[model samples]
Target chain A: MSTNDPYDFSARERDILRIVVGHIIPASAAYGLPGADDGAILADILRSAWREGRKLHEAAAEIDAASGGTFATIPTGEQATVLQRFREQHPGLARACEVVTARCYYRDDRVMRSIGMEVRPPFPLGFAVEPSELDLLEPVRQRGKIYRDAN
Target chain B: MVEVNEAVDVVIVGAGASAAAFAWSLAETGMRILCVEQGDWVKADSFPSVGRDWEERAATDFAISPNVRRRPEDYPVNDADSPIAVANFNGVGGGTMLYAAHFPRLHPSDFRVKTLDGVADDWPVDYATLEPFFALNDEKMGVSSLAGDPAYPPKPQVMPPIPMGRSGVTIGRAMNKLGWHWWPSDAAITTQTYAGRAPCINLGQCGSGCAQGAKASTDVTYWPEAMRERVEVRTHCRVSRVETDENNRATGVYYYDGDNIERFQPAEIVVMASNGVGTPRLLLNSASERFPNGLANSSGLVGKNLMLHPYAQVRGYFDEPMDGYRGPHICTWSMQFYETDPSRDFVRGYSYQFSRGHGPVTAAVNGMADGLIPWGEGHHEAFRSVFDHSAGMVSICEDLPEEINSVTLDPNLRDSNGIPAPKLTYRLSENTRRMLDHSVARGREILTAAGARHITSRSPLPYAGWHLMGTARMGTDPRRSVVNEWGRSHDVKNLFVIDGSVFVTSGGVNPTSTIQALALYFADQVKSRIYDLFD
Candidate 1:
């Protein structure tokens, strides 16, 4: 159960994860999004994924073995094929990776601003939503009391 | 050796919503009041909203379900057998700390479900009697709403309503088109500055514990004011059981302090303001030679008549982007579907509580779970599709009291203090199932009218047992009830329960407002008869 066990990721495992995550959320210039392999995001994802401990190490080994030890050096299309097969074979591993990666990705300040959100936290300066039309209640006002009284 | 503290005039258990109001009200009588709370005061700044991992924190740390949160102060409640889980907060403000602040009062008919709908037992007290207490609580707790709704008798309010945003406008327009009754919701969060607390800045973080001090958790609203009036509160102290004298009169409580050392705090009067589950657990654990079945359980109804308001959550996705997470997501609700209809399949109906769909993290998590958002390629696309464009309502269905759905101590499981954990054994009734189906269908209608492209719903929402009530109900019949009309234990004249545990029927609305009002009313009754309170 210790995260700092011998089952911690190897150097080869880290390289495989880098290539795998890049495919999970590849860079999108059109959406102005960074791939999950982006330096800081990848590190954050791996740090968070460290909690998965042996599960992560085992998944990385399985993913690497599926690509014939060339997952870190596979072509983009071949990598996708390998990942798809791995996902089908090991659904839990795919989910663990996706959860860690997406958690780090969405919370990134760059990603938040790209999606039209304020970079800062919710408090101190919260958003000011436009005031809705109070006149909308006019029709309901005309409808009149809808409650029942038993007493 | 168990430390014995000096005897106080009064000792209230659990400094949550009910205890806060009761302590504040009874403080006026100049009696020495001490409230023992298991959880410490929550630092709002330490809330999840202050960090980038706010969503993650909310889902895990500030989670509404105590089973999920599992903080040191929280005791586990085994809910594996129940469809709806137990949701509660153990801190100074209790459930208010993590509530959505959607404040709504129970209707007049809610008090007389048995007579009006021919289901459940009727409350010994009625809305007319508790009306003044509700009004006073509104002013004291800083209620914000428009008062002219025809839903009930005219209500007097002090503040204007919270902004509905585009989400509210769309929902309102849709309801108006359907000719259903809807109104701006009453929120406990402040719209304008009151009692020195800041106004809501629309953080949309009320559910994760409001950092802006806008949402009125009793920790901020009542405790501070009560302390100024000389009411004392001991935090991080869990009450093990209430003690009774040879005459069957209440004496005090046995509790574990911050260091987990057992101690006895004696009192002249004992008030049980613990939430529905905790109140019953304590009373039952207090069984003595005189009352072996359970203290104040002469009618054997102490842990009976449990009602966890069965909830139905329905979300509709719109094509156009709408205002999302502005603040106080529950800004308005519809009572059109409230009240019993003889034609419907259920005895009582439910109110539709509307809100913006999800925050960024929650959206991604839910989308991933639903298989709509993928890991590779078009992950961003699926997120954008449902992120801001989705809106929904939670049909707050009224749960009729049933003795079968109850909370009893597990034979094996225990808290860190070795106290038995309450095991919730609840099952959704057939009436609730039909009511949820109809509510879901009606919800789709409203969302479609508002131009939603698609709709999704989770009936009898699994993680939505937020409104715990009716385990120990109030009635005049001593053989079938636990407490009397004034919330005093019928068997033990000196004991009182002023929490949701005393509710007779689970109304189709959040019970925090009604719970506080009842606490105030019970305090008033106790004061009026102070000369012979034990009699």
Candidate 2:
């Protein structure tokens, strides 16, 4: 949140964003799945938004304004209501924020592991999927010669 | 301003899929072939698989549409008027650089759509004539397929088909339940190592340029062999216009080199392998005083009847994880609806390509956009539910060629070389809309049978103009078509166009394999009739 930080967000804006994204994708202790505000996800989101030229801070400010400038201080249920209104008013910004948060959060190792996915590049060590059973394709195969003949 | 003055036996414009095939076919003939490509050779190491940010790079740098990619080598296409945006690559491998390599053949019926369906014109040549070339191309490109496809003639030797992963198995089971014809895809990617290229590692990033050289892109499949046979491929050379003699025969081409220097390369025979859009753009740009309208516009059909297969996709999210990112992006497809039936509301039918959902980041963005994953409160739950639990199918529907859906020069927009940008005028026909609705309904049924919890469907993707065809159609009549059966220009005898531009009908399938086959067939024709090629 400092000037030297990669994101262009102020400390207050970052605090509001943390609260908003936490409400958006709250951590589930039962599933051990980390939320958008967990670990480096907020930093990752800020960096990704900065790289994509998305106005995350502006969206944060809009959410704060909608929540009467106390979005971070508000209760979780109240924050969700304010965020929903912000989403309704600014759909594009909502989509951008959602995309950035989801992209950064789901790609986090803990979230990926919690979802039973390997947190590595898909290549070099790809997952082993069972080969298809030819018997399952027999019905379509029996219908046979569906193409029109060439004259 | 340096002019490269040279003469070759055959000067081919564009070192794309067709050009690669043509050059490889003519390599044995010892013809002095020179192919000019606008983009540089995409090295294997440069593929996105080597990096962690492959998904983001694929969306930006290696995107199928030039409008989005904005690469320096790419030419600007003014597709503002068209519903389907023009998507292609300008490099040595062309669109193959980022294609899924789904190498489906045109059905025997595709050649005679007019004779069978009573719509669209019949191709000048039939499927039987091109079957041998198809076989040859398949062998050379290391096609991973299974024989006895029933959709094709008896092809004896197809490499083992790529394993259909979890998504394919689920989809195949669903298709069977729905009593639909689904087959392990005939892909250009290799299964076992063939022709010195490595076998596929199942990276699921075939659309982002294959780093492993597994996907038989021409750079790895054909260009290497062609270059070894002394086919001169001058990369980063963008051809501006075809120069013609007094008799309206193509003398050679004027092109701009890497340094933006003008050069003229003369040749005995000039072949334009620059796909459907680029071929017509070059022909129209080559207007001479003798043929004032355009190079081969005696019929004014050089840029008419443009056809882009109207495409649609449906994604199904299931209760169980499908392991959607584990295999080739496209390894299974259904052709049950490929043939037209009177019971259907539309005249033509469409084929369904089953995809093993996209990579993680792509799925995130697409899922979010389609509301499969919501924004607030439930975002984590929604994302988790759909992350690996999705299957998708894309419909490649037949688009009838209409004169109004054409490619013309934009009066204002030009490329880096100051050549007029090709403006595409296209709209989905009523037939196409009907076909899409029918296809999507069937797609939903297949997904439903597979126990999908929810489904998301797009009627037609606006950025799905992958198969550009029929801008310069082939026919016997000189007045109705720009090229003849063998891709020879009707007016310019020595000129040939061996690309999707000569497709009489945009078959309800991917067109790359057919484009290569036709190029091989045309190369054979030139070899047999070299003495009288000009006459």
Candidate 3:
């Protein structure tokens, strides 16, 4: 369901989530890495399972309450502080958010490219790896019949 | 609903690993063989690889545990009482559909556990007896590995080994530093094109049903050839129970068709290749007036002595990016600690398999579970640091047969067919716990020596019951075992059990190779003693 649904999330709750997830994975210009807010990852976060979506919205509301209804207006560092406090109070919810955020972010084309990987399914044309040198296994070959003999 | 009663020379239940091996072995005999499987043939194109959500699909459509997949063809299993959950696929290839295809032969010492270590009972047959079958199956399945592994006897032949990714190289260096015996893995995935199957493309999704047909799952390796040989495999036919005659001999089986219609298939010989748990559950459900306790369970040990390999894993984070997601999931392993040592508190031992880290989704989930990446700020940094920089290893430790840990019909739970669901009641013994702790500790040391910045070690995953064994053991003594050395039922002359359920002791390595070998060996026995089998 859309975040506009009253039972799911209000406009204020959506804004707060954007701020919270942004701090969780802030854009790193130095590393050229896209953060949680980039590539519509926040939208992906909002599209989680109903139970997890509710948890995320409730967690956002909790953050707003903790930040005195200014979670979105607060500075990024301050937002991180409030989110960390919420995490301490609700570790499970925090983990849920982290899992959703990481899962979505890594699948993003921009994120995958930044990490030097093709943004595609690993099939049809799977990646290649160089075969190992046989000499590398010389030690194991020298140690003969490691298994005990049957009596 | 349509019903049919047909008689065949041989009726094999469950078209899984053992069943495929047995059917292929007996195909040359020109006997009328019929295999009834509950699940449909899984097409290669339907594999997860073609989808963008391949990894996610693995947790859903291609999940190893039937309880999670909930496919129409799968039966539910009640595993709440057990610490080690049973994870098996129900399709034509069975568990091989989702197996990692790591095919390691059981150690010779694994056969004589009682004779050598005074623990579990010795296998009725020794490793030497099954070596040729192992070679045959390996050749047919296109096993890939280096030639000179000191851990094994001289094998017939093998394809070139798969690439050892950076993770494997790191683990190999650590093993060398420790002077431990490590070798390239013996895998069922083809390294070069063989038997029309393409070489592995290194998708790193071997557990998600290989789409390229590179993985040697029985659906591709045996079922096709067996079908060509005129062995009839009836899909979507779930065998409910093995029917017995008034003389207490197994005659055939009662099954539910795709339309949920009941039907009977009569046969001169009935083979149970439905795995450790499924085999026992079927036998227990087939209780009749002639064999009240269960079919071929005159010793009252049909569902007793369950053995699930107690597994544990350790992940090491290296400073450099290992590109740990680039190759086969399991490409290297070490048997340095495979042999039992008096110094160790445990009786049997374990083998260590080196793994490149999981795919992106699994890595993300695992990272959160390990608390390596916390929720708030710097989460991205933590995730990035661990993403491609980790190498891992799994220790498949041997679990002894204990009568207390068993598969029984759940009193309340039932499957789609209204048959009682199999309930697994299991707990780690003190001995197993000690062994797990030891393996984890050893794993940590290896990672530490390998220049790991950090390491995460834990007990076995609940879903690590991939190697199910020893539910209905085989032995010479009819008073103590359900089946004879030839896998024939001791009480019923024509009944046979050709699966891991006939294992006397759970070996430290994966049981698929041994399971196929034993099935082929028993099929040979059936051919040699055709006259004796009927009498």
Candidate 4:
């Protein structure tokens, strides 16, 4: 995390996002899916957050401002309420951040494998698809000669 | 620096689909052939599918839209006046480099639109005349499909069709439930390792230039064979304009080479296979003292009558995984609403091309656009609902030729090579709008029948103008068309256009198959008339 990004996305702001990520996509212990704020996933999110540059920083500022500047020091139990309110008020920005988060989240090999995706490029060794059921075309075949015979 | 390089018997411009086919066919006559291409060879291994961020690369580096991708070779198109943006690739394989390879032939009635429907002009050539070439192209390009569809006259598929995976069978059953017609779409993809290329291993994203060499882009299919026949394709040479003599003959072309130096290449005959937009752009740019308006533009219709088949997309999220992405974005399609009906709102109809859903990133992004996949607590569930659980179709609606829709030289914009850019002026006809609505409704019906819970649709899709055509039409009369029946330019006898630009009418199906068939047909005509080709 940059200590001096032009938009004030400093180390202090990074800590706030870590809290924000945990609340947004909390750990799904039942599914074994990590929270968005998990060390590795959060790193990817932060890198991608940098890609979305100022908007994310602005989102951070609004969340901080809305939380009476106590978003960082606030109890973990109360962060979700503040974040939820921020999301409801600024649905578009929150979603933009979520998309960026999800994009980075899904691209992780571990996350991809968890989703049953073969954590590799789809070339040289391609995926397997179920066999085609040409029998389904029986109905269409029965109704045959659908083209206009302009000839 | 601007001196003539060398003289060749025949010179072709743009090394795309038609150019490759035409060059291969004409090279049989023991004549020297040279092709000048604006871009270099795009190697199959360099395709994005070989990388982890393949989907992201597709959205950026290999984007189909030239204005968005803006690669070095791509020329900017001013499409501010048109609803649909121009999509093309500028490399050796041209648009085929990024094409989905859907490869469907135009229907027979598409030829005589005016005669059958009393709308649009009739093509001088009939489907029967080009059927043999179509079959021939299928063999050379290694098309794969099961041939028993009752949609049209019977034709044999070169190989077995790609498997109609989960999404296809799901949609097929839906169509069958409604007693609608659906069949495996004819794809220009090798399923049996034909012509030394490997068969597709179910590698999903064919758009990222099929690194497996399964997709039959001209670079893999025709260019190698054409090269073997000594048809030299000079890449990175952007032909600025065709030089015409005082006698109104196309003597040669002036081009910028790889070093960005200008040079003239002399030829006895010049053929233009530079697609709908590129061909018209070049023709209008080739305006000289003799032909003030444009060469081969005695009818003043060189860049007019632009026909971009308007496309409509509809998506349906299903309950189960639609299997892995297979075939050319689609393996099967419904022709339930193809061909015209006297009571219908439109004259020409559309093809229901059932499509497979996108990769993960694309699915997430599309879902977000629909506002179903929000960023909050339900993000993962919404993503899961869409990712592999969606099936869709696009209605390739036939757009009738209109003189008002045209491509003209942009007075302001120019390419890196300093050639003036092409400006597009187009509008969706009221007839087409009604047709789009009807098709979208049908798309909804089929998807809903297939047990789709959530559906989203858009008509006259803004970025689906991949099939550019009809700017320079073919007709018997010189005053009515830019090229004659055989694709010979009326004003300049030695000049010929063997691209989609010479399409008389935009057919409901994909035009690559027809484009290649026309190119081969034009080459055959040229070979037969080489002794007396020019007036």
Candidate 5:
């Protein structure tokens, strides 16, 4: 699917993207916003990701080239196998994932402002200033547990 | 030709929180009621998350009237076309469809703040009088909370408490340790399945509109029930005036249909549930020579004493990512330090509700360094860093009623119907200003106790229109208030104004629950033949 489209996602691309976002933000699980069967919003994100040239399948291709097996063809469980290696070994992939998720989740900067919040960088890393409180206990730091059972 | 509409026993205006409840209460009376809603109907399946495409605009109603420009005399604080500053939905449920559903009752002490604390005017009725109605509102709205907690009055709750995440627990623990009272909020959302609706899935998208049908929006609960009882909901109709006879008996109403065509419908009575802003605007425009000041304004108190629940936020970043952004919008209670205490410097109190973070787009706007320029990569990174790393508390402060703060007709501006819009002039009182400072200090202290790495706080910049209330106050005296204790216009018989506009005082909590309770009570009063007092 073309990224220029408002919300377009391929099935395979959506499945992997949904699980990744669910693992990254786990709150979506509490609202039942993201379940294994619910592929709607997840599909949109993946489509947007592809349009942005940060396609998960393509990124998986790079990971496959660096490691051995291709990421696109791997089974659900095996997909985790490939990502786990990079989360631990490839610092670049971990940073890239963080960057990608932040950009995707906070796409509506103007909407957020209407409600009295601004988006800024994480401080030192970037100087974008949105007024927000810092959270020390972010679940993403618990990276050892791949694919949290919930989201 | 104008669409001469069908007649009903009562013609109600607006479909937000107040209007929905009014329709729900009056529907069972077997009276032919017509509710003219300005918004359309929205169901759960039509929400953003459940749509066929992720960004199909997702059933959102953005109703910015293009043709109408607000005159300076009409909405001095806003653009000509944007006389009303509130972001309301153009749907069947109105703002109820989009609200976060935080249901908190104004404390008993809230009723007599003026007499008790010497702050503002006293409510014509006390909390004890309205307590039964409050319970009634809780039952119908499906409020979820453990009510036996001594902090609030004894009331029955339908849904159980929504589980607070680590952030709520941390704040709860920290606040309790400080000898403050905090409980799970009484939100009008189903914690478990009730009345054909599913339990809250905790998607934290309460603000965006609940797709799971868990939130107790009027459209899902009251409007449907009203529809079953045969309350006719007319969408896309904007009511402009309430026609009254020389005796001041409400006869009918005039409005514009979807096509901007003027239409008139007669009725036995008129109930203005058009909320704080809309109600006052209508009254200010319904001016005739017989009632030169305004409709039902014999005492000239129709659009005076306007108030809003001025609010601010205090942020706290803990050592761990509390993941505060993951659950319902407001899952925890507030510290009632100044709620009833007579020892406080301020006359009224303020309450706080804990909040989670927003999505990336929202977060970016929030991270837009409070006083910085609009753009840059540095801005983008700042937004990303705190993507999942923030949580805060919202402080809803009670605004003291001031005669100077008001909504009046703009002499020059006109709405789409060629009727004058309400021009508001408001400023925060010195006492409220001090209260904001005091609450910010208390918020910072609590965040510090919770071991926050960074804490930030904000206060309203003077007259920031937040919680609109008290424009047409209720009291026995026609000289001071507009409506009587029963919300019936003291000056005009058969003309009743429900909603936040009739508030004698703006309490330190959300007005939805209280307003719903008042609507139920007034409906019962009308049903019980007490309205004959005027006849």
Candidate 6:
């Protein structure tokens, strides 16, 4: 997989990922900048793959080929459907997302935070609170609300 | 009747920095000199052109080849062919051909380390004695630096200093805001059109053999001038042993020529400027029946009290374009807090050097990730923005000498020549580990202040191959050191070892400038016949 080439996502995968990352690190519509869902973050991650000597294009192509349709062709609704099916049908995507979300958050979050975008959430199954008390950043606690405050 | 070989006045081993300086100085005396180099001759044109995105030579060990770089079976530290942990340049100027050209002198207190911080033993000679030699070395090397920089000790530079770029300016401002001391770094590069050489063009490829001849890599400066004076530089000749007589007076050396055949060359005096690791290994290999241990092991200090400069790195990603990977490898430094403070955990201090960020290829491997939808238009956009938005700095630290951190020959392993391999058994001191932790935290703070998007760093540890020094130190006492103040071994009269191996303590500063100055001083002592004073 050549990490340098732009990932040719199926329409469905593109729509879902773009929307997911936009919401993960939501972009400010008031700033006149493109929303995080504009696919900039995904493209940048693919470019980083190339820098790392990986074939992002090939990896994407394999996923596309396995889905029996190009990733760019699938709709966001279909991408969400295929991903849920992917969780049941294929083990690779499930394992890959498990690792990628945990690792890329620290490295990729800086730019997202700078531009007022939140990284998209991944694998909600692993999101349980730890036994210890949570220590959230002040700005995050005040501004970033993941769920409705019970109070 | 046996024929007597032609006698050279002085035979120097290893055509590295010190050897080149010694050759140039001795050539001025009109003495017949022969320099045997294990490497080939390299010229400025030999370097890869700047226009190309180049890969380093595999032989130079710059790439990531796990098997080829260091073979664990034959050599524990490195490979059989390149067994020593030290970086090797098998060309005209040795490793100086690929150095980053960041040259800072060890302070006066660095020499008297034992007295100041109460750590290692003090040098036989003080900074005052070697100050004149330092000026001579600076003048000869065409060092570019400025005076009145409060960050470092008091020493004037001969040439005008290089301009600090945007990254240096940003880092400098941030350091000041945080109450840290910083200054324009002293470099061994020609900043102006001085001595018929062009000034640095800021290609940022100084580590990979400068093609412009602006960087002082001995070949274009001292070695060429020495050649003009009729000094014979025999390249591709590896000196195996420095042969001595029954009376313990120096004779000459036996070396393998370009061919595998061995040849014996006789000379009056022998000088070994073959770097820190190689010099000690050569000495240990020169064990004769008369000298039961090694050539200069009367005090059993031939290869004891080894030291290495432990370094840590901090990388920052900034919003504004820093243009960091565009200038010289090093042009700015922070030496304001160079003196030892008892409040700090470490006995000695460390200097923070602002240097080149990772190039494109390495950054992708280290910076980018898969989570952001690797399959699409998003990947291309991320690649373009991050390349220009990165900045980084390095911490050049001082490591106190420990007797346990010694270089011994591996009993079971051997090189291609069937020679025993040098085994480096070194671990970081508790003080050094603590120092690294402090420096990394400080670096993180600086990056955050500079508005870094995110910062990441490895825990502080001793990295191999930046600046290795002090395997064989210099002192008056035979039991404490291997060489005297002039770099001549105390046990042997005519055998001199001029290199970083003669450093008494691994100062926080880079040792190249001091190494060159000490080499010039050793040459002066030899030329003026100052042995009478010593006797």
Using all chains and alpha carbons, the TM-scores for the candidates as numbered come to 0.94, 0.93, 0.93, 0.92, 0.74, 0.75
Per-residue lDDT of model 5, residues B153-217, tens digit only: 56787767776666676776677557566667888888778888887766565665777787888
Docking class of 6: incorrect
| lDDT (Cα, tens digit) per residue for candidate 6, span B422-508 | 767666789878877877888899888777877777554323354557777888888888888788888778889998888878888
lDDT-better candidate, 3 vs 6: 3
Give one digit per residue, the lDDT tens place, for model 2 in B439-460. 8988899999999999999978
Clashing pairs in 3: none
Worst 10 residues of 4 chain B by lDDT: B323-332
Interface RMSD of every predicted model, in angstroms: 1.8, 2.2, 2.2, 2.4, 18.6, 23.0
Question: Which candidate do you rate higher for TM-score, 4 or 6?
Answer: 4
Model 1: DockQ vs. true structure: 0.60
Give stretches of model 3 more than 4 Å off. Answer: A1-39, A42-97
| Model 1, CA-based lDDT | 0.86
lDDT of candidate 6 over A1-151, digit per residue (tens): 2224344444454444444343333434443334334454465533332222233233344456555854456675665555556545654544443223212332344443443323322111111111111121122233322211111
Our tally of clashes for model 6 stands at 36
Count residue pairs with overlapping backbones in model 3: 0
The weakest ten consecutive residues by lDDT in model 6 chain B span B51-60
- Count clashing residue pairs per candidate: 1, 0, 0, 0, 65, 36
| Inter-residue clash pairs, candidate 2 | none
Interface DockQ of each model: 0.60, 0.48, 0.52, 0.46, 0.03, 0.03
**Segments of candidate 2 deviating more than 4 angstroms:** A1-28, A31-34, A37-39, A46-51, A54-86
Candidate achieving the largest TM-score: 1
The number of clashing residue pairs in model 2 is 0
Candidate 4 lDDT by residue in tens digits, B153-255:
8998799998888889999888888888889888888888798989888787777799999999999989999999999999999989999988889999999
